[model samples]
Structure formats: structure tokens, C-alpha cells
Target: MDNRKEILDELSGLSPRLRDLKAKGDGLTTPEGYFEGLSDQVWSRLKDSPKKETVVRPMRRLWRLPYKSGIAAALVLAAAALIWLNRPRESAAFDLGALTPQEAEQYILNNIEDFDLSMLVASRPEEIADPAGAGRTDTLDSELDQLLDEYLEDVDDATLEQILF
Candidate 1:
């Protein structure tokens, strides 16, 4: 009880200072006026703030800018394309005799003795003659010749040129 009474006395002694503080606080108690006063300052601060400006380059200028390393490649490709388009079209000519000088000619001109011509002849049949109903060996040889002729014809001109030339 006595401690409470002492606290009350101390509070009573602070009454005058409290009132002075309250009076000072009351001078700044305008709710609408405080915000209104700050409105112009806020807008002015915003208006004075720094702004970033962006610069855009022209498209044509960007296209016209020199490419660093690919200029040589582009020039080469363009030159090749121009030469290809403007070149005179000529039929392909071939003369195998003109390909190499005497050295290469000597390499291919030697006579070949490795080949055997006997295998090309027709084989002899078991019997000398077909007495009952046996077919002739000449018919089989003729058929083989026809087949070989047809096979040769099937070989394309380009393939033949590659082999011969």
C-alpha cells in the first residue's frame, strides 16, 4: 500500500511536464494538414528524381555495320556463286589418251598375259548325241550368249564411261 502511494506522488509531481509535452504535441495534431503539407513535397521529389533515357539505333545502320571476320567468307561465297551463275555451260569432253604423258601411258600400254581365253568356250556334254528327247547344247550356248548381251546392255552409259575412261 505504501509503495503504491509513493508512485502516485511521483506521478503528481510529473503533471506539469506532462501537460507541457501534451501542449507541444497538440500543435502537430492536424491529420489532414500533415498529409496535405507533404503532398507537394512528395510530388516535387518525384518530379526531380533522375530518369534513365534509352537510345535506339537505326535498323538500316545496324545492317550496314561491317561484319568482323565473316566478310572474307561472304565474299568467297558470293564470288563462287557469281562465277557459277555467269560461267559458260560446256558439255563434258573426254579423251583418255590426253589424260597423262608418256610415263602413265607406258604403265598401261604393256601387254597383259594373265587372262585365259579357254574358259569362254562351251563345255562338252556327256553324250555325243541326243537320241531320245535330249535338248541340244548349242541351244544352251545361244541362250548364254543372249543373257550376256542383255546384261551388257543393262550397264548404264555413265557407268560404262567411268570404267572405260
Candidate 2:
């Protein structure tokens, strides 16, 4: 007990305010009705503080531009259409009806190599329906026919069917 008293005397000598607070039991005293008006004190301080200036940023532009390639394509198509509509008309100077049967045959014979035989046959379908099916063909048409005939004469029907079917 004497040792504890000596320690307390040393502490009191160091700080008189601490010794006085110890005598008073507790030094944490508040103003009257502090707890009752706590909410009002907080609100009053909040209202008195300086307000922040709001930033007024402008809205960014939308990416709603029309397609450049699409516009160019439309323009190109319009130009092509206009040119096609206003094109020069072909003259009927060389009438097909003015051609004689012999002259036409001579012209065809002269340019037989140039003409596509399949296209010719397709054009003259009525010529396909010959009397007795006796097809009148020139050297150009009969060349392949003659070769085929010689080939068939050599190969038997069974071999021909195997190759064909």
C-alpha cells in the first residue's frame, strides 16, 4: 500500500490537472442538452459549409452520319441509268428481210468457222423437223457425224452402251 501511494504522489507531481481530474472522478463533461440538440448541430454545420460548383459539360455528338460508300454507289448507279436511258438508237439500215436465200447461204458458208453450230441449230429448230428425218447438213455439221459413224461401226452395241450409258 505504501509503494502504490508513492507511485500516485509521483504522478500527481508530474501533472496537477490529472490529479484534479482524478479528484473530480471524470473530466469528460459536456454542455447542457448537447445530446438532445446533436442532429441540429450537425445540420447547421452542413448548411454553413461552402457549396461545390456543378460542372456543365456539353453532350458529345452521335455517330449517325450516312454511309459515304452507299451515297457514292447511288450516284454511280444514277449516272449509269441516265446514260443507258439516253443512249443512241441503232439504225435499221441492214434489214434481215432484204437478204436472199442464196446470199444468206453463201454468207453462212463463208463464215461457217466463226458461227457456233449449236447456237445455229437452236435458232433454226424448224429445220430439225425434216421430211423423213433426212437431216440436210453441210461439211461443217457432217464432219463429226462421219467420225462417229466410223467409230460405231468398229465398236459393238454392248461396248457402245457401256461407254455411252
C-alpha root-mean-square deviation, each candidate:
27.3, 28.4
- The most accurate candidate by lDDT is 2
Q: For residues 23-46, could you state the per-residue lDDT of candidate 2 as single tens digits? A: 566658899998999999999998
Off by over 4 Å in 1: 1-53, 58-68, 91-152, 156-165
Instruction: Mark the 10 consecutive residues where model 1 has the least summed lDDT.
Output: 111-120
Q: Compute the lDDT of residue 39 as modeled in candidate 1.
A: 83
The TM-score obtained by model 2 is: 0.24
lDDT of 1 at 106: 35
Off by over 4 Å in 2: 1-98, 101-115, 130-134, 137-165
* 66-89: candidate 1 lDDT, tens digit per residue: 753466678899999999999984
